[model samples]
Target: MTRVLNFLRRPFVLDLRALALLRIATAAVVLTDLAIRSTDLEAHYANMGILPLHVLYERNWNAYQVSLHNISGLWQIQALLFLVAAGFATMLLLGYKTRLATVVSWLLLVSLQNRNPIIGQGGDDLLRMLLFWGIFLPWGRMYSTDAGRTEPKPAAYSYFSAATVAYVVQLALVYWCTALLKNAPEWTTEGTAIYYALSLDQVLMPGGRILYQFPEVMRFLTFATYYTELLLPFVLFIPVGVPFWRMLFVVVMYGFHLGISLTLFVGLFFLINMASVLGLLPTPVMDWIDRQVRTRTQRLQPHLTRLSNWRSPVRVNVESSLNLPPKTIQILHGLRNAVVTLLLAYVCWWNLDSIANPSLTMSEPLRWFGYLFRTDQHWGMFAPAVFKDDGWYILDATTPKGRHIDLNRKGRPLTLAKPASVVSLFKNDRWRKYSENYLFVSNAYLRPYYCNYLLRVWNEDSDNAPVRRLDVIYMKEVSLPNYKVATPSREVLCSCETAPPAK
Candidate 1:
C-alpha cells in the first residue's frame, strides 16, 4: 500500500525551489501586467472611459463577479488600486508573507479582469488560476524572505499536495480544452489553422509575415501545433522515466509557446503560459539551477554584505501556526485538503462545458460557486477555428466645419485604406483584445461607449480638430485559401453624435 501510494504521488511531486522560482516569475508578470494596464487607466478602467460603470453593470457585469475598481469610476482611484496591487505583487515576488500576498494578488487580478471583461484573454485566466493554487502551495519554503537563512533539508526539496495536483491538472486542462473546442476541420484534417492565423494582418508579426509566404511549412506547423496541444500534456504525467518525461514536456512547451510569441502579437500570453510550467521542471534541473544561483550569490557575497550592513535588518517572518490540539490540527488540514480537491474537481467540470456537448454538460447550478471564486474559465482561444474576420478600426469623425478626420490616426484626414500594420494601431494587446470583442455581433453595445470616449478625447482641444460626430468603422478582411487575399469591406460599426455643444 505504501509503494502504491508513492507511485500515485510521483508525477505530482513538485520541486520546492522551482515553486519559489515560479512565485517570483508570476509576481514579476503581475507587476509587468499592472504597469502596462496603468498606461490606460482612464481609457480602460475608469467610468468616463470606454465602459462606464452603469453600462457595465447593465450589460457586461454579472451578479457573482466583484471588482474593487467598481468602488469609484475615477482614474485616480483606479491608480490607487493598481499601486496597491503592485505592492502585493512585490511582496509575493520577495515571498514576504507569500501565501497572503498570493491571495491578495489573485483577488486584485480577478477584480481587475472582471472590471474589464472585454479586454481579457486566456492568459488572464491562467495567471489568476496559478495564483489561486499558489495560495495553497508551500512555494515560499525555500529561497525567500519567509525562508530566512535556514537551508532546506533534502526531503524538503520536493512537495506533494492537493494544490500541486490541481496546478498540474489545471495546465493540462487548458491545452486539452482548447484542443477539444477546436473541432473545426481547419485545426484537424485541413491543417490550415496556422495559415489562417498568420493571415490575420491585424495580428501579424514579422515572423508570421515571413512564414505566411510558405504554405507547405504552414500546413506542417499547423499539424504540429494541434497535435502538440492535444498530446504533449499527457507526457507530463507519464510514470515511466518520470524525470525524462517531465523534462521533455517542459522543453516542448517552451518551444511551442515561444513559437507562438514569435508569430503572433499575444502580448504576455506566452510569458504567462511559460511561467505556469516553470514549477513542473524535473528536480535535477531545479537542483542545477540552485547550484548556479548559489555560485552567483557567493561571487556577490561581499557586495551583498556591504549593502546589507547599510540597510536595517528586517526579516519578514511568515511562520505562524495555531497551537491547537493534535486532533484539531489534523481535522483542519484534512478539511483544507478536501476543499482543494473539491475545487479542482469543479474546475475540471467547468472546463468540460467548453466541449459544447449536451451530454457532457456541467450543471449551471454549480457554476456560481466557480464564479464566486473567479475560477470560472474558458479556453477557446482561436478555437473552433481561428477568426477569419481580420480588420483594422477607422475612427472616422467629422469636424464642426464638416471636415473628415480619423481619430485613430490622431485627427489625420479620414481614409478607408488599411494601415501598413494593423497590429501597430492598437496601443497594447488589451486594446487589441477589446477591438476583437468589438467586432463580435454580441458586443455591439460596446461600440457607442467607445465612440463617445474617442470623441471626448479628440474634442478637449477642440480648436485643432473639433468634431461634431464620430463613426467607428471596421475594415473587414477575411482570410481566403490558395494564398488569396480577400478585398476588405468598409462597415460602419457605430456612429455617435455628441449632444449639440451644450445647446
Candidate 2:
C-alpha cells in the first residue's frame, strides 16, 4: 500500500519550471482559440446564426447541462462572455491569480462549447480537461506574480499532490482510448488509414496532396501512428525508465502532431495536444532550463544593476490579515482532497466504461454530474474507420433580381470548377467543424439552418447583390486504394427562401 502511494505521488513531485511552462502554453492556446472564435461571433453564437440557443438547447441540452450563452438571446451578451474569457486567459498567461483564472477560463470554454456543440471537436474537450486539472495544480508557485509576493522564497519544485497523478493518468488515457477505439483493420494489417485520410480534400492541406502521391510512405505512417499511440502511453508506468521513455514520448508525439498540422487543418487540436505534452517533460529538462535561465540572469546582473542605479528604488509592503486556525485549515485541506479524489475516481470510471462500451449509458445521476460539469469525454478520433468520402460544399443562390449566383464566389455561376483547396473557404476550426458536420446524413437539419444563415448574411450585405433563394450542395470524392477515374457526386441537402432583413 505504501509503495503504491509512493508510486502514484511520483508525478506530482514536478519541477516548478515545468508547471510554469504549462501555464504559458495553455494560456496561449486559450487566447488563440478565443481569437479564432471571435472572427465568427454572430454566425456561431447568436440566434441569427447557424445554431441559435433554442435549437442548441432542443437538440443537445439535458436537465443538468448549463451554459451562460443560453442565458441570453442577445449576441452582445455572448460576445461579452467571450471577451471575459479572453481576459481570464490573459490573467492565466501572466500567472496572476492563476487558479482563479484557470477556473474562469474553463467555465467560459465549457459555456462556449455547450452553446454550440457542433462547432467543437476533440481538441476542445482536451483543452477543457487540461484546464480542469490545472485548477488543482500549483502552477503559480514560480514565474508568477504570486511567487514574487511571498516573504520566503518559493521552492523550485512543487510538492507531491494527488492532482498530479490525475493529470498524468488523464493524458495517458487519451492516447490509450484513441488507440483502443481504432479497431479497424487498416490500423493493423491493411495500413491504409492515412491513405484515405489524405485523399479527403476537405480536411487535407496542400502538403497532404503532395504526400498522397507516395502510397508506401502513407502506409508506413499509418502503422507508425497506430503503434505509437498504442505503445507510448504504457511507458508512463515504467518507473525505472521514466525519464528516457518520457523524453522519447515527448519527442515522438510532438513530431506526430507536427505532421498532422502540416497535412491537415485540425484547428487547435494539434497545438493543444502538443501543449498538454509539455506537462510530461522530464525533470532533467526543466532543471537544465532553470540552470540556463540562472546563468543568463547572472550574466546580465551587472548591466541591470547599473540601469537600476539610475532610478530611486520604490519599496512597498503588503500584508495578509485573514488567518485560519490550524484545525480549520486541516479540515479544509481534507475536504479539498476528498473532493478531488472523488472527481478523479468518477472520471476514471467513466473512461473505463467508455472504453468497454462506447455506447454505454451512465445512470441519471452520473450523467447529470457529467453534464453539469461538462466532464463528458470522447476521444475517438478516426476510430473504427477513417472517413473515405471527402468533399467540398457549393452554395447555389438565386438573387431577388432573378439572377443565379454561386455563393462560394461572388457573381460566379454554380458551374464553375471546384477550387484546388477548400481550406480557404473556412475562417477557422469552428467553421471547418460546421462544414464537416454537414457531410453526415444524420445531421440533415444543419443544411436548412446554414442555408438560411448564408442567405441572411448575403442579404444583409448592402454592397453585394441580394440573394432570395439558396440550395446547399455537397460535392464528394470517394477514396480508393488505386487512383481511378471517378465522377464527383453533387447532392443537394436542403433549399430555403431567405427571410426578409430585420427592421
Candidate 3:
C-alpha cells in the first residue's frame, strides 16, 4: 500500500514545453472546428446535435426532450457547468493544477460529447481519448504554470513510455480494423461491383462512367485492392521487408483517398484518414520542420533588422519615451496581471461551453487518439425496399443482365445492382456466413470485396413507401476488408430504405 501510494505521488521530470505545445495546437484546431460548426447549430439541434454524447445522455436520462436548442436547464446552472469545463481546459493548456484540471477537463469533455450523441465520434474523438491517457504522464514539467519543479528528467520518462505506446497501438488498430472490413465479395468480384457503384450519381467520380468501358481494369483493380488491404496489417508489423511494403501501401492509400475526394463527393472520410498520417510521424519530423522555419527566419532577419533601424529614429518608444513605469516594476506587474487574467478567462470560457450546453467540448486530441472510437458501420445490401425477420433480413443485388437475383431472399448473385432486375449473383459460403452477422444491426456497415472494389450497402426503412418499403440498401466505399478480423460489437441502427412499391 505504501509503495503504491509512493508510486502515485512520485515526482517525475517531463518535457512540459512539447506537451503544452501539443495541447495548445490541438485546442486551437478544435476551437477552429467549433467556430466553423457554430453556424450549423440549428441543424444539429434539429437532429439533437448529432453528437454521440447527446445519445449517451438521452439513453441515460431516458428523456429525449433535454436536447440542444431546446436547452431546458436553468441558465445559471448550465453556465456553472460550462465554466468549470472551460476553466479546466484552460488550466490544462496552461499546465496549471494539472492533475485536478486534467481529470475535471476529461470528465467535462466526455459529458459534453455525450450530450450531442452524434457529432463527436470521429478521428478527433479518438485523439481526445488518447490525450486523456497522456494526462498521467509527466508533461507538465517544462512549459506549464508549475515550470520550476525540481524533479529528475528520468522520472518523467517512464510515464511517457506507456502513454506513447497506447496512442500508437490504438491508431494501428483502427487501420487494421478498417482494412479487415473491406474484403467483401462485391468489392473483389471485379467489373461487377464498380459497375453498380459508378451508376449511383452521388458516388460518381470524374470519369467513372467512361472508366466503366474497360471491364478488365475494374476486375484487375478489384483483386489488387483486396490484397492490398489484407497485406497492410502484416506490412505495418514485420521488420525486414515491411518498410518497402508499407511504402507501397502508402502510395496506394493516398491515391485511393485522393480519388475518393475528387470523384465520390464523400471527401470528409478520406480527409480524416489522410490526417491520421500524423500518427506515424515522430516528433523529430516536427522538430525538423521547426528548424527549417527558424532557418528561413534567420535569412530574413537582416532585412528586418535594417528596416527596424530605419524606423527606429522616427517611431516613438511609447512606454519608455512616454516615461511609464520603471523596468523592474513593470516586469513584476505584468507577470502578476497575466496570472490573474489567465484565471478569469479560463473560468469564463469553461462556463460558456461546458455547463450551458454540456454538448460543446470534448477531450483533448491525445487522449481520444488512444482508441479507435467509431460509430457502427453496418450498411446492409441496398435495394429498393427492406425485409426483416427475427434477426436477419436477406437482401438482393442485381446483375448487368437485369434479373432478380437475391442472396438472402432468392439466391446469391455474381454482382450488385446493375440490372433493373437482380440476376446472376455470386455467393460463397464464407460470404453468406458474414451476411448473417448483419441480421441484428441497424446502422451503417461494410462487407468484403468478393469480386472487386468495396461493395457497400445499407438496410433501412423510409416514409416514402409506408407499407412496402422493405428493400436492400447499397452504397460503396472505394475499399473493403478481406483479412482476418475481430468482429465488431453490434448495436447499429438502420437508416437504409428497403424495397418499396414501383413508381
The candidate maximizing TM-score is 1
Please provide, for model 3 over 1-503, each residue's C-alpha lDDT reduced to its tens digit, 9 standing for 90 to 100: 98765453222211233444455444344343334333444223222222223333444332322223234323343445555666666776665666676666655555444444333324445444434544544444434554433333332222233343343334444544444444455554432454454444434456665665666776665556455544664544443443354445456667866765664433234554554333333234445654665566675766544222210121222355566778865775566446534433332333233222456443444223212222112212221111211122324344334543443433444333343311112132122223333342432232212111111221222321122112343322222223122322232233332234489
**For each candidate, C-alpha RMSD in Å?**
3.1, 4.3, 16.8
Please give the range of 10 consecutive residues that has the lowest summed lDDT in model 2.
310-319
- Residue 243, model 1: Cα distance from true site in angstroms: 1.5
Best by lDDT: 1
Model 2: how large is the Cα RMSD against the reference? 4.3
Model 2, span 50-162: residue lDDT tens: 98777877776677877888887678888899899999999888777777899999999888888888888998888999899888877666555555445454433544566
Which should have the higher TM-score, number 2 or number 3? 2
Model 3 score (lDDT)? 0.40
Q: After superposition, how far is residue 365 of candidate 3 from its true place, in Å?
A: 29
The global C-alpha lDDT for each of the candidates, from Candidate 1 onward, is 0.85, 0.79, 0.40
Rank list by TM-score: 1, 2, 3
Cα displacement (angstroms), candidate 2, residue 334, comes to 4.2
Model 1 alpha-carbon miss at residue 474, Å: 1.0
